[model samples]
Target: MPAQSANSTSPAADRPPAARDTDALLRAELGTAIRKLRKERGLTLVQLAERAALSHPFLSQLERGLTRPSMPSLHRIARALGTTQQVLMAAAAVPHPDIPVGSAHLVRSGEGLPVARPGGTARMLGAPAYSVHPVEYTGMSEEFQDYYDHPGDEFVYVMTGEVEIELQAAEGPRVHVLGPGDSICYPGGTPHRWRAVGDGSLVRLLTVQNATGEADRHHS
Candidate 1:
């Protein structure tokens, strides 16, 4: 064997920086997190760009913190990285508080006005990759409509009551009736409609899309 190196035997030689500027440290940490997640998922920059429907140049800038991503853009990147917006946001340093009831951001449909659809509510929780929210419908007569489309896909899981979903496809329409504990997924490009069923409130947990795309309108 060759002679042992002095630096190789030193533990401090391989240690990370103990103190850094807050802003610079945050940027470095965010960059490292993104790079780590990307590598762990075996995706190259080009592949992640394709998945997020974003230009490779923009993503490169984001990776270097030369460009700051908006919430939607961050969500897209997280999805492409096989993570959640909530996780990415947290890694970027958003603060959260704990209370006696639980975390303050726990969302329940009907507690807040609907952001995308009417008659129902959606709460967004966590970073993009690890975020979750609960949706609640007040009554069966309530029919919710929201227009959305993205580069990735979505899964809707019904937790209570029932829902009638109609997905608008290039060829035509596909209808699905979902009950408690039932779930379904479709391409992000498919425009869709949702309506509550039966005589009680409907509840669902939706895994929202995290890609870039224009919303499509469906009339029926």
Candidate 2:
């Protein structure tokens, strides 16, 4: 059996130093974001969990950064908080300084905001206020099974390792395996799933998503 990096729900002590740090930072950022949103909505933890249909203790752990939630769970929480996952992600990142409407922004390497994932880490590489949201996912495991369907145009580029992507397109379900340097782009509202494909070594990919669709949906 291939050795797994760490538990999907919690960080492992034996993980590489960098991975562990990423995990910890992601957890803390996510927790803080959730808590802040909940408070801003004037809802208590119990009320928010009830609305999200999640366990109260689980939400508590999430707020404490002791545990991480799956994509579906995070989506549920986001909806309950009257926001989208992308907006929540923006909140999770280091607060962007208020720049003028037409000014350019820069994000240095390793300065991107960390995002929690099941068996790996994802960083938000785009400025929070940008119209394009770029994220880098690293060390994704084979067990990753988050399927997404939302309003946005998404482009994916494989950086290292192999990835098997399953897309529910207009014609039918399509599965594609991508290697280094491969890329794919699809419109929003297409259900899709992707995971690392190999000896469980982990994979890295960069995804750039246009925020127009999601932003429209958010305000509508």
Candidate 3:
């Protein structure tokens, strides 16, 4: 066959008009989904823009489907919304491969969790309640305490070494010493401080409170 010209139409050009319409619909749906999620979170456009490190005008345009955001921008927005890019992309009607039973990707805490505090490594194994996090506490030269109050609760199970947990209570500070195989449950709203005892690193598996409740149901 003779060489085809660069401007020649390919087989893709023969696709039905519905296919093109579907793509446009997906793009619009993705934008609308993100905007709805932001509104549900009670975050203003400016607040979300600041969190995503995007300009207000650009974010507004994105929410309106007036502009297509780059992958990085999408990633930032997903992070701000406490979700993954895969979820956001799916909202756009993009099909993703199903995760194999034994091949689920491991998300590193150092990469995903935005630790506002210093010291120790906190990794999230799943979506808060459905996950476990391995927190490794090294030498405590600096007092690391960051006040974070979220909606849910957690149970800390000490795997190795000793951990001192100080909960801020109405009466006074409540201190608890936990060792290997020992776990403690406390309200997530309570401000707390953690320190590794001795010079060794202390490892703990922090289970989500909701999961703990489910486990309790099975045992009870």
TM-score of every candidate relative to the true structure? 0.42, 0.69, 0.44
Model 1 lDDT, residue 214, Cα = 21
Candidate 2 has its poorest 10 consecutive residues by lDDT at 1-10
Model 3, residue 220: distance off in Å is 26
The whole-model C-alpha lDDT of candidate 1 against the native structure comes to 0.51
Backbone clashes in model 2, listed as residue pairs: none
User: In model 1, which runs have C-alpha deviations exceeding 4 angstroms?
Assistant: 1-94, 98-116, 128-141, 144-147, 211-220
Give one digit per residue, the lDDT tens place, for model 1 in 1-220.
2211111110123433532233344445455667777777788988877787777766676667544454445556766765544345335442233333333443322222222224443333333223332233333434544534444466777778788888888788777889888898887557777777764345454554433332111000
Question: Candidate 3: where is the Cα deviation over 4 Å?
Answer: 1-39, 42-45, 48-117, 128-142, 211-220
lDDT for every model? 0.51, 0.71, 0.52
Residue 166 deviation, candidate 2, in Å?
0.6
Per-residue lDDT tens digits for candidate 2, residues 1-220, read 2221222255568977976776677678778878977887799988887787787788888898887765567777877876656655654454434544437655566655454566577767764456677788887768648577656788999988998889997789899999999999998778888878874455888998776643333322
Ranking of all candidate structures by their TM-score, best first: 2, 3, 1
Candidate maximizing lDDT: 2
- By summed lDDT, the worst window of 10 consecutive residues in model 1 runs over 2-11
